[model samples]
Every structure is written in structure tokens, then in C-alpha cells.
Target: MSDVLQSAFNAFLEELKNSESLIRLTVSTLLLILVVAVSRFLLRRFIRRNIQSSEMRRRWLIQLRNILLIVLVLGLVVIWGHELRTFALSMVAIAVALVIATKELILCVSGALIKGGARSFNIGDRIQVKEFRGDVIDQNLLTTTILEVGPGRSMQQRSGRMVVLPNSLFASEAVINESYSQDFVLHTFSVPFLRQHEWRPAKQKLLELAQKHSEPYLEQAKRHFARLSYRTGLEQPVVEPRVTIQLQCAEELHLIVRLPTKEHDRNQTEQAILAELFADDDYLGDYLPRV
Candidate 1:
């Protein structure tokens, strides 16, 4: 067995020795390896001597390794340029197959590029992509990590869940940047009541509560929306507190309250309004559903 293996290896070497392209490839591979290895060694030595902090040294080493890898890849492409040209048709077919196999990965990268080029959202920006809505905690080429903001939008608070979404989703789904308004936003929430209840008084009370809670920031929000409209050429939206009535069904109705509040105070402001409205049932006593 040893003798047979030795003979096979010798024959393989002899065949390689005779082929000019094979010889060039072999020589180029060794030369590239030697250059990368030496460069890496020198880089490590310099970094270790000059960089005192362990974290800085680690970062430098990582960057150096990445540069060396890029150099090795470029070197191989340059050395195999002629051979690659000879197999251009085969390469094209292989490339197509690879693309099909890695379609999601390609989409993810393309999505990331599109997001960056468009400046769709940044870290800390609350965004809604289809059913998933959250604040972007981290983002990279393949995925985005968000602190999940809802079991549903009715609760404008984090659900303590971390959702990692493929960047590819950005390509297919519309990304709504909720934080685009910056400091102040016109937020809306629903207050459900029985259809038999007095919705008129409830509506008036809700408007009063919303207006009271939003009074401090109402002027600021108006100014912000004014600037936003001027810059974006969009018609300025109404920033005052308002209540719109809607019938959820024959038995139930909803009072949708639209109010301007600080971006981070949606839940708090809603809670405050509801708390005051339902505190003693005196304000909405007739409207409250009986147990």
C-alpha cells in the first residue's frame, strides 16, 4: 500500500512539473503564502511592541489578519487570471449556481447596502418592518437585532424580547421609521367602551385629558412638525389633541385619541390619561361597563 501511494504521489509531482500552468500555480501559491505569513509576523511584532492596551492590540491584530486575507485572495486571483479566463464559461455557470444556492445571503447583503445608501434608520431608531416593530439595537450585513417593542402596538413598550431579523426582509417589506419625527411625535391610541355608554362625554373628557397631558409639549411638537413639513415639502399635520369616534362592532366602540407627546412618553402619557379618566368612575361612571 505504501509503495503504491508513493508511486502515485511521484507520478502526480512529475505531471505537475511538466505542466507549465500547474507549475506557475504551485509557485504562485507558495510565494503568496510566504509573503502573507511574513507580513503577518512583522505586523504582530510591531503591534505587540507599540500597542500597550490589550484591547487595542487585539483590534490591530484583527485588522491586520483581515488585510492579509484580502491580500491572499487578490494574489490568488491575479496569479490565476489567465487560467480563470480559459474557464470563463465554466466559471459563469458555477457563479450562477453559487448565486442560486446563496440567494438569501446575497439578498441580505443587498438589503444592508440599500439601507445604508438610503439612511433608512440608525441605531436607537424605532422601526416597524411588517409585523415586527422595535428599536434597532444592532445591525450588520446579514441581520438586525431589535428590542421587541410589542406583543402588539397597543402597548407602546418593550416586551423584553430580542428579535433578530434577516436584512433581506428590508428589501421586501416596507420599513416605517417611527422615530423620524425626532423629539416629538403625534401618537394615537384607542380607548374601547360599550356602545351603550355615553361616548360623547367620554370623547370630550379624553380630549381634555389628552390636551392637558400634552400641553407642555404641544407647542414644541407644532414647531417641530412645522419645520419637518417645510423641509420635506409635506403638508403640516395637525398637532393638537383630538378624539375620533369609531365603531369596533355593534356592541363595542372605540375612541381614538390623537395627541402630540414627547417621543419616549407615548405609553406614559396614555397611561396618565386613562388613569385620570378611570380613577373614580365619577367622570366616566355611566360609560363604565358594569361587572
Candidate 2:
């Protein structure tokens, strides 16, 4: 009985020693698992320590961390126990297979990574990607979620349904990130003016109203623009609120008010300006342009 038990134990050890792939895969997996687990633990702790608000941004970061960890573990498994030549050949084969099997998916993921790494946009940013314009609510490996905006149900109201767009769209599409780098975007509202109404006074009044109503955003925009200018070696953008007058139809002028404010606050700002104008009723007087 003792001899049989010893023989069985010896045979088990011998199998383990001879199974090169199994041994290699097991060791590599264990090592990678440990490294990823420890690194992620540390990273999460650091993020919690530094980040003030634990919002959707933090959730996104956590998701990113998990993805990175998985990639790292898979990479280590591929590299371990394989000779350099073998690893290179394997990688080439895998790449070829991926191209053949999932070209579109690979493109989408690559585009998303590029967009995120380049800081082209972020969650909560108001952006127009191609024809879809909305506030970005969620961004993942393959797709981004947008809350639609525009005219009718498409324009003003936040569509309760979220739009999931492929990240690859950004590569071939023009992306306008309204809140990129800065919290405020320039919003322009145009009002028609009759030729009989004096344009200068209307412009002055519009400028004053914009400045008064958008004071907080104007100040914030100034600081944001200043920093961006210094970093990019561009002229500091003028954030002081103002209105421009344009002669349009022979019968009317266009009063264009440019205000610095959060993109999401555009409707509110427009309503406020109009309310103020209607309440005073003295700026344009009896010469108000036909609506």
C-alpha cells in the first residue's frame, strides 16, 4: 500500500513537470493575476484619495482600470514561456486573425482609446459628433452614450432614451466638443432688428444684459482660456460678453449676442435675456421687428 501511494505521487509530479504548456500557462496566469490585483487595489485607493467627487467620471475610470488589468494579464500570458521568435510569430498570427474576424470592432475600440487618451472629449461634455448632438453621458470601449439635442424632441429636451454610437464614428466624422478643455462654450443667439430701430443702442443693451447674466461663466471662461492660450501659445480668447450687429434683409438688422456659458444652460440664458428684454420693453420701444 505504501509503495503504491508513493508511486502515484511520483507519477503526478512527473506529469506536472512534463506538461510544459500547462505549467507555463499556470505560472503566467498566477503571476499576472497577482500583479493586476495588487496594481488595481493601489490605483483605486489612490483615486479615492485624490478625486473629490465620486461621480460618473470615477465610475468610468474604474471601468478603464479593469479593462487595462485584463489586457495586461492577457499580454503576460501570451509572453510568458514563449521564446521571442515564437511570441512575435504568435502576435502576428493573432493580429491577422483579429483583422479577418473583427475589423469593425477593432476599429471602434482603437478609436475610442485614441479619443480618450487624447482628451478629445469626456463624460458630461456637450458634443456634436457627425449629425448627432448631445451631452455625453457614458463612454466605454466600443460606444459612447449621448443625450440627444436640437429642435423639437431632438433639440431642446433631453431625450429620455440614450443614443449609443460607435466610437469609430469619430474617426470619419467631424466632432465638435462644446465643453472641451473648458466648462463654458460660446452660444450665439440672433434677433432680427428693423431698420428704423437704432442698432447701436440695442447692441449695447444686449451686451450689458449678457455680461450681467453670464458673469460667472464669463469669469470662468477667462481663466480657462488664459491657461489654454499659455499652453498652446495662442492669443488669450476674449471672454468679455458682447453683441455684434449685422445688416441683414433691407428691412431688418441682426442682433447677435455672443455669451460664454455652459452649453446645457443655453436655453436658460436665451430665455433670461428675452425675459429681461420683454420686461423692460423700453430698449426697442415701438419699433420692435415683426416676429
Candidate 3:
């Protein structure tokens, strides 16, 4: 068995020695790939060690990985430049026919390129394109899939459907990113009061309740807004949870409550606020009047 194995190894080495250029190129390509991969891994480790706590570190890591991959691709082209060009030229007619035959595939690939360049949305982002609305669960060069949420009354709840959308959709549709700046969104609901009732107390109490429930998300928004403003050159909007008294009609005084909430938690936060409203004596007896 040892003699047979030695013979086989010697024959393989002899074959490789006979094709010196091919062996060299093959080994060099593997080495280049390994070097690129190791550098990427080391860069990731360094970032994790030093900048793991940084807010924008994840974006930076992704960018660095892309740059390394691009460099590896260019390196391969330089190493096998002549052979690749000749092979590509020979296959040009066939490639053209394939592209035309796979029209949808080409469109999807182009759309993916456009989507990446446009920075339309990212994974875990809740987006609405056309009538499809959901959280992005997966994306590929050919398709972008979402976990479908909401159908009728259950607006925020998942509908147990995974929507597989072709990346091509972004070329012709508007994408509404619900929580682009932060993981939270401004959610508002109103409570009713009689016009004869003193409104200030209700407003004050609601604001307090909203602030209490919304404090964490507000803090997160503040951090995200710092980055968002720096990138977009847009002024930060007032994120302090507040209550506004709006007269919906002559017959009704609407105590409008607004707060920052996680996109998934908006309904629950609204329900909790509503439940707490009547729990307070001021909100319940606002219309009881002067006795």
C-alpha cells in the first residue's frame, strides 16, 4: 500500500512538473484566495476586538469585506488575464444568446446591482414595495424575500407567508422603508374627551405615560439620529414623546398621543397606553364637571 501510494504521488508530481506554468498558476491562485480570506478574517477580528461597541462598525466591516473580495477578483484577472480574455472572446456569441434567452435572469441581476448601489433597504428592514409589505428576511442576486406581515386588521402581525420578490421589482417601484433611521418609528393614537372637560391634565398625564413606555426607544433613536443626521445632512425631528389636544369635532376633544415605538411593538404599545388611560382617574373623570 505504501509503495502504491508513493508511486501515485510521484506520478502526480511528474505531471505537475511537466505543466510548470499551469501548476504555478493554480498554486498561486489558491494562495491568493487564502491570503484574501485570511486578511478578511483578521480584519473582522480586529474590528470586533477594538470597534465592536461602535455604532457604525457593522457597516464598516461589510464595506471592508466587499473591498477585499473585489481585490481578489481583480488579482485573479491579472494572473490569468490573457487566458480569460481569449476564452471570453471565444464564448461571446454563446454568452449573448444566453443573456437574451435568460432575459428575466439578466433583469434580476441588474436590479440587484441597482438595489445595492441605490442603498434602498437592508436586511431586517421593514419595507413596502407596491402592495407587498414585510420585513426583509433574505436577499440574493436574483431575488429579495420578505416575511409577510399584516393582511387586514392585524396590521403588524406576521401573516405566515414568505414573499419571494424578484429583485427586478425595485427598478419600477417605490420602496417605503419604515424604520430607516432607527429601529423605532413614531406611533400616534388619540383618546377622546368632552370639550367641557379641562384638557391640560389629560394631556400632561398622557405625555408622562408615553414618555415612560417610550424612553428606551427614544434613547436609541437619539443615537441613530446622530448618525442619520451626519450622513443625510437633515435636522433631527423632535423625538420627545408628547401629547397634543386636537378638537376632532365640536362634539369631541381628541387627546392625541404620540411616542416612538419599535415597529413590531407599535400595536402593543398603543394598546397599553389606551389601557392605562382610563386607569388614571383624571382621564376617566375628565368630563365629570364642577359639582
lDDT top scorer: 1
- The candidate that achieves the highest TM-score relative to the unseen native structure: 1
Per-model RMSD to reference:
15.3, 19.6, 19.7
Candidate 2 lDDT, 72-159, residue by residue in tens: 8567757663443444554566567657778788889888877877788878887887778888889989999998877442244566
Across 88-119, the per-residue lDDT of candidate 1 in tens digits comes to: 64456556766887899999998999889889
Q: TM-scores of the models, in the given order?
A: 0.68, 0.56, 0.52
Candidate 1 C-alpha error for residue 211, in Å: 0.7
Candidate 2 collision pairs: 150-154, 150-155, 151-155
Please write out the lDDT profile of model 3 over residues 129-181, one tens digit for every residue.
Answer: 88899889999999999998778423666789999999889877888887686
Q: Judging by lDDT, tell me the better candidate of 1 and 3.
A: 1
Q: Give the Å error, residue 176, model 2.
A: 0.5
RMSD of 2: 19.6
Candidate 3 has a TM-score of: 0.52
**Local distance difference test scores for all models:** 0.86, 0.74, 0.79
In candidate 1 the C-alpha lDDT for residue 243 amounts to: 96
Supply candidate 1's per-residue lDDT for 274: 92
> Pairing residues by index, what is the TM-score of model 2?
0.56
